[model samples]
Target: MRNVSRCGVVMLSVILSAGLASPAAAKEPSSEPEHVGVLDAAVESLTGDVYAEPSRWRPLSLGTLFTEGWDQAWASPTRGSGGAPRQGWIGAANGVFYRLGLAAYSYAHDVGDNGDEHAGTLTLYTPFSRRFELRHDIPFVVNNKGSGNSYHTNVGDFSIAPRVILSESQDFTQSFG
Candidate 1:
């Protein structure tokens, strides 16, 4: 019990002194609005459910390609039975997390307004350390559509990466269950 009290006192003193000594901490509240304003604008412009929609609105047969920045990118093209083809694209660059990106695809046969679909993505990223990093501008939303009762369409994905790597590395893998 005595040891616990001592530890508590030490922690409290350290926290108080650190706060008092930090200029950034003292000035932080005033600048918080700027960050909030920027985030509001971003949230307003990029709207919708990112997962419910396909990345591409047009077919790959139409020769549509998405172009963006040096941060990130995602593209997926797929074909299945009794449905149209699907394509997706996602990407991001500049600003907070350095760069982040994402892309995926799904195809349905029949229903109502749903059919085949695909999506691509690009992500820009920034790292805080070798074992941790941040990602932003997550999903740009490449394409989305269907012939039946499909309700998938949205854009703008933001994320953070503890560790970043490329497809060449085994850090990323997928499994179906």
Candidate 2:
């Protein structure tokens, strides 16, 4: 623990010194067109694409929370069969991509003169393609009964799902997995 604390302090000091030394190293602002409205500005900032077209704009889904790219339909000149755009799977941004996410949760309970219990979970989401995604969870538990104390930890379940887009229009999109 002492070594870990020393390492953390050293890393923080380095970072702070580097930032302070580069106070004037900021990039020059470019002459780009300003967004039209509040919503447009917010979307542009979040997507990191100031030139994204409004016609191809889509709402931010679970998948797009990590990355953004060009729509598959516009990637090629030819449309899908029947001249309709190829709708990607649910949570997709209309192209092949992958994303990884980590999240943590904790719960605690206590009862008078009885015992105390605590639980924690760590979840991971790995989306490997436009159509398939995987999810896994790991959990641990602790309990204190009066004077005696016990701790337990274990792995949790995992699942995979393949998604498909059923129908999509300018205003609505439906998908299933």
Candidate 3:
């Protein structure tokens, strides 16, 4: 579990920094403006004990990952990249439950290309009650340079996720991602 989280952090760093190669903005004598950091939130649940001890838990999770690059850009020679903080989140709900959310925040300087990056997403799911299930997630990205920084973003891929029940126990659940 520790290794997986570390890998996720590394991958996110690479993606955010790739944007740092662009031209730097003209130097301004005034104080640099500050922008608000991104915030992400999410919620979820499993049929049985997804993270339960006896059953060993697993589930196919689908959600947007956020990245930020601001803290890194400031040290650049050309202001080649610099921005504000960033964040992200993932969550789900069904007829049985409501308002469940799960979320994560970007590290201070994880923004990839030398600019601060921020993002958020919303999703809608249908019970499909039984075993098979379907879900859709709409994701958004926001990268800010500062108070008046330029913006770069995308709605991200519209994907279809199909979930199957592999195993379920009274206190645990196991599924594949």
Candidate 4:
């Protein structure tokens, strides 16, 4: 996360310096602007207009946060790339993601062992990137067979899988990892 912020700052600075380093305007008599750092509000004014009109396929109330958000979700071949509205469900190529859900878990044992167990469970999916998704499950424990503080909890082991998009088509998509 710290790396992401540092990279963003560097990128933004490069864009601002390049965009604002151009020659001054000839007709600049708009009542001396206030000083804001080095270039007043001039730099801000120029950068604010970077985005064009929203694509017809999708409109955004806000920018996609860390490249994780919804897209048009339709597999179309006509859409372009880069700041253009997506035309398919392949929304993000590389970014962190999280999914929270629930499940019903069941278990049974022999006559000499524990009888049976049925409980709700919480499933959390944490992705380091689009290529690798990790899942941790927490079961609702009615009992823990007299274990310690940590073992007495309802926590379960994690299941991790590295994923990749194997193929994409106008009709469908495939992934493997």
RMSD of each: 20.7, 20.7, 27.0, 20.1
What is the C-alpha local distance difference test score of each model? 0.35, 0.42, 0.35, 0.37
| Error at 90, model 2, angstroms | 18
Writing each residue's lDDT as its tens digit, candidate 1 over 1-177 gives 999999999999999999878986665433111222333434422332222322321122111112211122221212323454332233322212222334344444543444545444455443332112355445555345544555466664655444332211112211111
Clashing pairs in 4: none
TM-score of each: 0.24, 0.32, 0.34, 0.29
Q: How accurate is candidate 2 locally (lDDT)?
A: 0.42
Which candidate should be chosen as best, given lDDT against the real structure? 2
Q: In each prediction, how many residue pairs overlap at the backbone (N, C-alpha, C within less than 3 A)?
A: 51, 0, 23, 0
Arranged by lDDT with the best first, the candidates are: 2, 4, 1, 3
Q: Which stretches of candidate 4 lie over 4 Å from their true place?
A: 1-100, 107-114, 126-132, 140-154
Error of 2 at 2 (Å): 72
